[model samples]
Target: MQTVPMVKQKVHQTLDTLPPQGLKELSQFLDFLKYKYQAERRTNIVALGGIWQDIPFDVTDEEVRALRRRVTDTLLSKV
Candidate 1:
């Protein structure tokens, strides 16, 4: 298989041969490929964030603090 430098040299040679318009389209295509591979996919997660927001149940700050204190007490007891 061709090494990284060899592959890059080949790409540069190909770029050198393309017309100005072809180079513009290539740049857009490259941007698309990068986004396609690297973009974070948070659609489903963000949708789930509000799924229970409409529910009638709600935990107050005191409830959350009590739970955290219980967890910390347990950990400290073990230590």
Candidate 2:
């Protein structure tokens, strides 16, 4: 595997050879990579914490399951 410095040098060399449009495309691709990486690192529990907090603590397992099914159905229907 290439070291970090080696990777940086290679990237710079490649960037130098790219035309203006290629550089723009590379910038967009880098942004997408960063967004995808950050999104993958986030946990579902962390994402839903605030959204689920309003639900009553006494809710039963069955209710949760039913809600999940309804949500899945609704989402699948859209697809």
Candidate 3:
């Protein structure tokens, strides 16, 4: 029930490239990105450090909620 932009899809596409292990880590990263962007009013450019290198994503508000729902549904269905 939130109004967001449509950049989250781009974030998901970026996420899809990650390995399964990376995907787990990415869930936390996505939450941080969403909070940082929405609360902190950041643009679409987040970085990933360590062996993962630098990963950047451009997420909009709408996409953020949509992707969150999508991921949650997918995960729930699997469980």
lDDT (C-alpha, whole model) for all candidates: 0.87, 0.91, 0.80
- Per-residue lDDT tens digits for candidate 3, residues 1-79, read 4335446676768877989999999789979989887977656654667865755456699999999999999999999
Q: Count the backbone clashes (under 3 Å) in each candidate.
A: 0, 0, 5
lDDT of the structure predicted as candidate 1 = 0.87
Q: Pick the candidate with the highest lDDT.
A: 2
Q: Write the per-residue lDDT of candidate 1 for residues 1-79, one digit (tens) a residue.
A: 9999999999999999999999999999999988987776635533324777766556699999999999999999999
lDDT of 2 by residue, 9-78 (tens): 9999999899999999999999999999999998874333676777656769999999999999999999
Tell me each candidate's TM-score.
0.49, 0.55, 0.30
Q: What pairs collide in candidate 2? A: none
Clashing pairs in 1: none
RMSD of 1: 11.9
TM-score top scorer = 2
